[model samples]
Target chain A: MVHAESSTFAEGLTKEEVYTQVLEQASALLEGERNWVCNLSNASSLLYHALLSLPRPSSGVNWCGFYVVDTINPSQLILGPFQGHVACQQIPLGKGVCGTAAKEGKTQVVEDVEKFPGHIACDSRSKSEIVVPILQAGKVVAIIDIDCAELAGFDEVDQKHLEGFARIIAEGSDF
Target chain B: MVHAESSTFAEGLTKEEVYTQVLEQASALLEGERNWVCNLSNASSLLYHALLSLPRPSSGVNWCGFYVVDTINPSQLILGPFQGHVACQQIPLGKGVCGTAAKEGKTQVVEDVEKFPGHIACDSRSKSEIVVPILQAGKVVAIIDIDCAELAGFDEVDQKHLEGFARIIAEGSDF
Candidate 1:
């Protein structure tokens, strides 16, 4: 199913079509564990893995990672699996993309990293990024962080779709 | 804002409006208490607090509770909270409105009690109900279980509003 060449972005697919596709695929994906309907952490790790398995994940994504702030120690975001340069695993909840996303419970899309308050350069090659918060009950629990080597790599499509995916997994979790 | 009068059906309030109100006021409710997030063991206690804070939360609700399958313990919904009588604390994940909502990750609006499968009659006076799951990442973390005292007590307004509130709180997280 590696179909980056056949991706809707390249093919210019309709929003309704995309919405239908996602809706149609929702249950199957949920049952398949892509949405991880039974668990939160494992499902997120699975989501990152699925993204990595996608075609051209690396070109657009300089890094793909998730971060969980230490439950016992609140000052750091322990790194989840990632594909990128050495990252600063420990950052305050108000610093950098991961931190801000966690702090605001809103997605942070940076088309220009240089303008961000405190952009952490995990990879100097990275030029833009998007960080979506994993919200639980209204507080920032974690974040699905993606960095792209290209500027303006993400758009409303990615925002709505990825957030939809996050909703599929996080909206009903126990942990 | 306790507007719903008894001896008659409450009508005209849209679920979307209730949901928007809940979302807009979420930060105000959950921002200060060091957060009320909970787990299976303390689930009831958390639900008790939520029931108190939710807008006019008592109008249609006779018993509002929280139930979680003791993941480590297995097969029983550990008791959490309620504004009324003692409840059947342990319920299977696939059984009642609570279980079904948790299992299906969809809101369950039961207008008739006799037709409800595995309907736990904690309150014989309650003839109708609505249940919404609190999801996180994509898993059923917890459920917002409400039991109403009248037949056909919950309408689409209740269902959609409850669902939206469940999603927002579960995602944005206050506890």
Candidate 2:
């Protein structure tokens, strides 16, 4: 109940399972030693762990990342934290999904990555994505993003759950 | 002595006075009623307080602000917690002093706003400028900037102190 019950190879899981898993994982990490210093990291590891707690593990997302705008390099988003393949690190702010979202302060859900413009294919198997902007006050501060190896993987349910996680991040960490 | 004695304005304040003031402020705000949150505002307020902490009252710095790369808007840096008149709310990543420093990853000093191309004029009264990008994991996250009403007002000493304040902020806040 504290995690997504299904795996990528299996069918999806129930929503309750997904929620329990996500909360349990986050609570553990937040209560752990690294929770305080974890922000110093690329920060993707924490988000990945949180996602793993979902009940529908078969949503098939294996890669996750957090992107922050580089104040020194205003034209790019510096990769903050991630748990996945080596991605296109210096993403142009207005170009890729990450960049465009960061550029406009909006959320982007791509059902198919291949069809997206300037899609940086860091992972050839990633077929779907859900990117949400972490907002502070009225502006965007960073993004919590996930990528799946399955097609049509993420849904409204995923969005709602992940958004819940994003709120926690916005409240707890300076991402 | 940790921070107060080392400050350039140390001569005007006794250690006891400094300790009493800080303790009083901390107790009044942190423990009593939580007024320090009002004290610990954005760069504009922090910088203003820092000036008050100095030996002489400061003027000329008619405006102060922070430019952070917008997490949602990747191609531009959005304005954040700051003081002064209404500022250019957005600066392109590769363009002006704020943008160029962010793009090039360095501290930028502009002796005259008129001399800097693509200089954004939120207030025509602002002349000289200084910008320092705060970085985390080799990535720029924010900029601490000050604009003066006079030319050639900022230098290495100012950079060091302002950077010191920026360090406190970079380490103190969540994001």
Candidate 3:
């Protein structure tokens, strides 16, 4: 699979088409690439570039990245490969959106960060966020974190697709 | 002071001018930002974007990122924030470009990764490499590592300027 092609997603593709392509691209990029660090690194870039190829109003995501449970300190999540501004390094379980998702073992779709209680403002420019936890053996091992500068940047379509994206990473990689 | 401006770099800027802008931008982004993770995260993106804005021939850097000395495993360097393909996660002290720079408390500039003995081939696309160790209190705390796809990608100009870039992060941020 040639994952490094210039045009991973064709122009004029519908939003859904773009996402399906992202999933296929994710699979191809992660195929036989089992190292957790390497997998997450590539996946983050894959999503970042995927969004960059999409049309405007759906393309300007400010950040796309991951936060993994720190094996050294299980009580916290440490920053992994990310695109966009600098992010919070460690988020305690149940603290911010990433933390809350990790603690609850679920996905968090924040239409606006300002309204989210106890939001950790790592980057003031991030107005919206979506976080999906990646589980291995029923234990949450990491969270796929994405942030956007626009309000209501994510919805059910994003939630559904990204959950699938995270699932591919969780099931395929050796976390 | 607005660091998010569209054209962060002015046109017709020399390589020296571009590096100076990078240094200044690092300061602006790090001002009052004490979190080492946040500082390094933004710094890596800043340099990545800075290189992208430079003249074409000077802007083909394949990777720009950091590797920190793993506190849990003091003898090893763990992957940190990066822009590029997936990289090797654990690099032992006194090994490879990043580890050698960390162990010796100096910079390692490799015109070719193939010729460097024991060079860990994390990203096969990275042909040239430069690793600058970040020191705090006479001890290497972390390293600023960059890779390029082209041969002899980095030179004395990058060395001197990036050493200064690493110094600002070390002295300005609370690691």
Candidate 4:
């Protein structure tokens, strides 16, 4: 019988502790399932709910999802599995935060989206954002995009953990 | 500039009216975007949020998502874009509510999931479900699955509207 597993973080855990749990859980979830779609879909849910389980700042996350490199148009990134509001369907490389991350093949952590030049406002309420490029064999395959309603919602802790998360996705999935 | 569009239903709309709006909005969101992943991602968010915007029974929705026929394993359905907790990664054709719809290429509206044999409980809180197969070229390509927390959450109206929603997805996406 198939069972529904809870993705919530345990009570009283620090943000780093919660993220540690998340990375472990994500690895376990992706163990034998190398399908990129499945892994990414579940990973987003796991990350979204884990963030929501925390108090402010982290809990201020309004959007958590992905944008994958378009197969037909290599210079663009298409929307992928997400746990948030409807978003832009396509973003070209080097255009916005997501596009910049994909084009530069590096993580873009914007303390204030308004301060970032060419930041694409996919969600008007998103004051801060983080985009982690998932690279495989030195090529950008996809990106993990997180939007927060609070300013400076993401810091180095998030950068380090999310980069680790991206590595897990890169090594776990077939993409 | 990429702008985030709201998918919320207008206030005080009846259930049928809300569904009508959902169908129209889904079409507009899907216009010119034939990618199945992007379309399904947005469609699931649209439907899930639309349902949540309504009053109880409708607002009791616990999950809404899609499962496409596996490209590698023809008889299995792989998890697709969704708006809910994490779900089962795979369901063999003819095994559960989602699988049955995929295998039969028909809609399955179960008033009480517990009463249905071979029901796979991806979410234990799901008391009811409606699964509509998206058929293309006379074969099943994907399924739109919705789960509700209330018993008998789905009726003929839901079946009809969701079938229409399935048709829109079938015709709009490349699969």
Candidate 5:
């Protein structure tokens, strides 16, 4: 009967501190849960609420979720668990930001999504986005995708911490 | 690029009308998507935001999500996509409201969760709940679980509409 604790951040916590707390919370939440569906579902909720608890640019987060490699179609990434409005159902590898992250097996942090060629507009309000590849054995199994309503909403700090967050997910779940 | 449409309801729309619109929207959102992960992920978002657009008791919804029959462990239900606080990762058959719905292959609408025998409280804020079993070929495959903050939050209307909602999900996806 593990219930989801409401997200509440202490005042004056820096962005790094918040992410650190979020990653710790995610680890605790996913403990003893090896099912990727269950782990990713709760992780997305935790991350989305954590971002909402932050201040300014970070608080502008509009979407936070996952896109996992489709088992039926290996070349595409199907929408996984997410906490946001509805979203794109499928993204071909090497196409959108999420796909590129999976294809290149690296992180993609776009300060302005409009400047990225072939950028997919899943939500019109999203001006910036960050996609982190969740790699296992040097191959991407999924990606952590976040969108912000303001330009330059994500930076190196996000890339670093989110990559750590992705590692936690990869290790904690049997993907 | 199919972006999630922000949920909006016309002023004075009846609950049935809202449910009708939600079902239609869900059908449209799930079109051509047979993957259960993609379907359930978006379905939960659509349902959660749709309930938020309603007034009063309906608007008090605190949790709206799903739990599918575990692929590895057939006797338990692993949490599926959802839009709410984190929830129980797994529930044994016939152990909770969701389990009862799946075990009996029927709907369970508890007016007060405290009174339900062996109720599993995944969110303390949930005062009432409704669990609708998603059946495919007379076997339960998944469930539609919704929780509200007030007692008797769900009634016949919710059961009817949510059952319709569940059917839409079952037919649209390859669970």
Candidate 6:
């Protein structure tokens, strides 16, 4: 019974609960969808809407999107599907938080972007960020990046859940 | 001086003035960028941020994006880069507003989507819409879609400006 509808996670749910639902909904939404662009597009929407449905006092997410490794220029990561304000179009492979994540093959949970050296402030409103590298065949192919407007917005729970989300995409997608 | 920054127009600026700046920024952003995906990505970002910078009480815009004619399935339009909430992925040509725009090779300015027969309610919050076709060699290649939350949200001004916007993309992009 799954359709193109954006699924809504229950309100006042814990971060882990929200992400669990997100993973399930994402799996359903991404079923039989092999187009990398199309999958990333829906994945961003899933995360953005699920997080926005959280209860009051929750740190609102300002951005959710992907930075995909450029096929033409293998050393750079170009902006992929995203939801939020305008963003930097490209990031060198080893520079910013996204770049570092890709380079080190690790998840970066930035508590405060201002303190993160070489952080590319694509939107000045983004106070905190979390990036999970999507690895395909031991190579960083893409990264799911999320930003919140409040300081210390992302925690280990978010990191853990988002990494799971990334694994699903990495394993499911052709890219 | 034209970096990847989103440009801002003045408050109370005329629609023509707003679109004039949009075209200018669009041209600046599209220069030497021939990739259709990259161009459409930045174009959507340009229009979204440009309209969002308008003054208070202005009819707020909810979604802005593109539905590109699928090369594999020539009779359908697939969702491209976009901002705002999640959106419908595919539209059979001539079925909905975006499809009709692609089928007719003209612009569709729907004052009230409720009255527009066959209007797909991808997002229920969208009250009005405008879709402009991007034509190449007299063939419909894609359509730029904008949605607003207010009834009668779009008008002749939007149709005129966005059509012009479409032309620039048609001529400027390699699609």
Chain B TM-score, all predictions listed: 0.70, 0.73, 0.93, 0.96, 0.96, 0.94
Model 1 per-residue lDDT at A59? 38
Q: Tell me which of candidates 4 and 6 scores higher on TM-score.
A: 4
* Model 2 stretches with alpha carbons more than 4 Å out: A1-13, A24-28, A31-37, A40-43, A46-59, B1-175
Ranking by TM-score: 4, 5, 6, 3, 2, 1
Please give the CA lDDT of all the candidate structures: 0.54, 0.58, 0.79, 0.89, 0.89, 0.80
RMSD of 5: 1.5
lDDT for predicted candidate 2 compared with the true structure:
0.58
- For residue A45, model 3's alpha carbon misses the true position, in angstroms, by 3.0
- Per-residue CA lDDT of candidate 6, range A72-125, in tens? 888988777877765677789988899999888899998899999998888777
Positional deviation of B47 in candidate 1, in angstroms?
A: 44
What would the DockQ be for model 3?
0.20
Ranking by lDDT: 4, 5, 6, 3, 2, 1
| DockQ head-to-head 3 vs 6, winner | 6
Off by over 4 Å in 6: A1-10, A55-58, B1-10, B55-58
Task: Look at candidate 5 and tell me the lDDT of residue B135.
Answer: 89
List fnat, each candidate.
0.00, 0.00, 0.20, 0.72, 0.77, 0.23
For candidate 3, please provide the TM-score of chain A on its own: 0.94
User: Recovered native contacts in candidate 5, as a fraction?
Assistant: 0.77
Cα error, residue B11 of model 4, in Å, equals 3.3
- Which candidate number has the best TM-score? 4
After TM-score superposition, the amount by which residue B172's alpha carbon in candidate 3 deviates from its true location, in angstroms, is 2.6
Q: For residues A1-175, could you state the per-residue lDDT of candidate 1 as single tens digits?
A: 1111111122244543544454334333344222111233223323333343344422366555566655756665545433333344356787887788888788988887878998777567677888887776876666778887778766776788778766765654433
Q: What is the interface RMSD of candidate 3, in Å?
A: 5.9
Q: Which stretches of model 5 miss by more than 4 angstroms? A: A6-12
What TM-scores do the predictions have? 0.40, 0.43, 0.68, 0.97, 0.96, 0.89
Model 3 agreement with the true structure over B58-101: per-residue lDDT tens digits: 57787788887877679987766777654555789999888899
lDDT of 4 by residue, A23-70 (tens): 988888888789998888889999998888888898999889999999
Error of 2 at B127 (Å): 62
